[model samples]
Target chain A: MNEVLLPGVGLRYEFDTAEGNRIGIVARRDGRFEVVDYDRRDPDRSRLLLRLTEEEADAVAEILGAPRIAERFADLTREVPGLSAGQVEVAADSRYVDRPLGETRARTRTGASIVAIVRGEAVIASPSPVEVLRAKDVLVVIGTPDGIAGVDRIIHAP
Target chain B: MHTSVALLLELGLILTALSALGALARRFALTPVPLYLLAGLALGEGGIAPVPAADEFVEIGAAIGVVLLLLTLGLEFSLGEFAASARRHVRSAVVDLVLNATPGAVVGWLVGLSPLGVLALAGATWVSSSGIIARLLTDLGRLGNRETPAVLSVLVLEDFAMAAYLPLLTVLAAGGSWWQAGLGVLLAVGAVAVAFVASRRWGHQIGRLLSHPEPEQLMLRVLGTTLVVAGLAELVGASAAVGAFLVGLTLTGVVADRARAVLAPLRDLFAATFFLAIGFAVDVRALLPLLPAAIALAAVTAGTKVLTGAYAASLDGVGRWGRLRAGTALIPRGEFSIVILGLAAVADPTLGALVTAYVLVLAITGPVLARLVRAPLPARSGPNVRVDRR
Candidate 1:
């Protein structure tokens, strides 16, 4: 990826795809985004494909990205016979609420890994040990069915 | 409390007229600066209507307008952007200065203006309107063009140059000796360097000091601090605009963004008043006499700006059409040129008429010419292209 600084405007990021097509995205200062394709005739000139407002861009990103994340983990779990993936919700009354993720020790106790935490509209992939767990967080766990169930019990335990 | 009914009525009417003119300008996809100036001319001493009661308010508002303009301009920048631009486009900036400034100097010499007038004119011609051109690029959807970075870099450097240029002009305009002017320049440049260092090292602290959760408090803190610093700069022979710019430079990240949002409306109001004040200062009769010279100067400088823009864009390896787009994009002269004239108008009274006419001609024409440049080939409808939204 090539990042170009448009001073007093915003940043332009350009990258070439495997298909040999060059694409550019201009992220403007005012939370606007412009997606463009470089003209084959004139490599410098960009043909604007889409203009997205901040909210629209976020929506588009989520639509394209949210499913792939879960699918990848499912595919990984499918590779092993006994492995499975499950979401363990962090309930409001859970002891870990507003506390660091490390304190749970779910991975050490049940051999299940917390791959990501979904909070509201955002996904925190590969959250660090110090990441604070909040109420209603959906933790994506990967392990055997028994391990996944054990991890869920540990998270919601009184 | 006593309120002047005449002042309220005239001020309200003037604002309404400005809004109408602004809408007209927007309909044509043009900056409202020239229209504001025209309105000011019409409402000034020798025009169709005069607002005697609002005169004092307009004058004071204009001063605040310049400060706010510079402050916001400073806020728009970051040290990283400035360094990257300066590193890459130092040569382009040099070419831009030489190509654009020489014509103005030659014209000033031909007109037999004093030394200060020549310097001021040179600066007026050298700088492009970042405000107008940035908006133009966005409006035309040319922000993704290959040459945009080159164009924007040149603008960044020019605005940075003004930090030094303004103080020198201020000292000279005040009839200071060469020694004093030199000292003022050094002091201003040093201040800029210190501002950059401060922003890098203690930006968070400064941001914490100024930023507030409440928009009203943020507005008050930023405005109050900027005005106080501007006054101090004026006291020390540096330009108040430069001082406000320094205040802007010290802020970064979220603080600058929120401050900008809160201050934007106030800046617009005052900036409109500033443009109007320039028009009010110059007699319409004087502008008519200077129109021919202004047109001639505009024609020459506009060409030079094209050359400068092309040179800058060529360095970025943009194609011929892209270079042309870049060149035409740099043609408009607006707020800063008028600010330069405002600083030096006292030195040469005729400068007001000449610059106002020059800016009026170019500000209107520059954007139109830029748009006329071959429109980007319509988005190719193919597997890769998708119209996500209107």
Candidate 2:
């Protein structure tokens, strides 16, 4: 996903779907999002505005397999090859605490993926490798049964 | 002498009843303005049972509501942005002035109102309700349209016009002499100018001063300053709401944001009361005589607004359908229209019934028309098909 500030207009978040439809979600200053679908051929077709609120946009994003919720589910299914999906809470004593996801060899060694980092009510979906994992962070991981066990052991390792 | 207990009870009853009516309005996807007006009419001076205990308090509440309404409206707009927009779209402003404001003035003349009444009526019709239009735009999903900027520019012009027009109306209603009215206008402009400069320069500082760490303190300070300024403006024979609006414009950035969060609930409460108070001021029987004229004026103004919008959008090079969308979107007049009439009605009671009738008809009609106009065009004529992925 690519986001751009439109200056006076709003924030435009543009992305291409798997089906190759170019979509843009323009979040206006007034907390409204205009979901514009760019038609490949017609300028008029691309000009339509399907407006939504933040919550509505979030729900739509989930349905579209994008944003926080859907991205996590997709990451889990993709990384695990359809085996195990579980939330492993990062205990205060865990070695992964205060470590960036890139520094953790959980993915390269264990073949497991951290789909999302849930801290309290806020969920950071599809966190980049540079994203630091904190204590008490609930990591939504995906892998085969052995890969899942490996992620737990590697994180909890003293 | 009314007992405090009786006053409290009456206030409670009125509010509860109003809440129920508000719920009913929301259920039907309509504005509560009409409902509030109807409730006011039913409980006012000539209604079935006039409210005796809390009448005075309701009146005070209504006044505060108007102040808050104008304040919040001012807060939403920045003078810098308004100046830029005004410069960019002078033609739209002129067209809007001619198409929208003229009808109310003409209607006033036809009805044999005094000069003040004509001005009052003109102000009432000149501005479409920003609150209503913003909601309609979002609901109809037209916020992303190319013509939306054009539509918004027209609205901004209307608001700026109202800031000046309100004081003129206030001076007129105060029965000032010609020279006095001239002076009033000058002072009004001066006040706005000074506020604009001050806000642009020192708005953040003022906002910081008002924006206390505690929400309670911040709310009190903001409310206190607004009331004081409003009172002073009233003392000088200008619109009090204008003063409050200036105060609002002076507080920008973080303070403005905090003010909105702190004052919105209070604004909503009093604003609702103001609408209800408008209804209460009206005599139900008088509404019957004005219904025909109100409907006629609404029909005329609706056309004029559409014309204004379409022309504005056309100037922006938007296509015919987009022009139509722009026109239809500007039809509904809500808060500001009511505020104008509310001020005028204080001097001339007859105007209340007329305005209430007019606002009600358009409030319902505007959204429906906007919705209908934006419906898909013919299959081949335009690419109106929306691609929604499941």
Top candidate by lDDT: 1
* Local distance difference test scores for all models: 0.90, 0.79
What is model 2's DockQ versus the real complex? Answer: 0.07
lDDT of 1 by residue, A113-158 (tens): 9999989568898999999998768899998889999989999887
TM-score per model for chain B alone? 0.97, 0.94
Candidate 2 local distance difference test against the native: 0.79
User: Per-residue lDDT for B1-390 in model 2, tens only?
Assistant: 856998898899998998998888766656777788888888997798688988888889999999999998877777656876677678988998888889888988888777888887887787898888876765555555567777888888788877778888888788887788778888988998899899988875686678776789989999999999999999998889899988988887657767887999999899988998888888888888989998999999999999999898888787777788889989988889889987877767657777788898998888888877743633344435353311
lDDT of candidate 1 over B1-390, digit per residue (tens): 999999999999999999999989988888999999999999995888999999999999999999999999999989999999999899999999999999999998887788899898899999999999999987777777899999999999999999989999999999999899999999999998999999989987898798777899999999999999999999999999999999999998778988999999999999999999998888998889889988999999989999999999999998899889999999999999999998999746678888899999999999998888974566566755442221
Docking class of 1: acceptable
lDDT of 2 by residue, A53-151 (tens): 767865775565434554546565766455777667787546566679888788999898887888744788889999998866778887777888888
For candidate 1, the TM-score is 0.86
Clashes of each: 0, 3
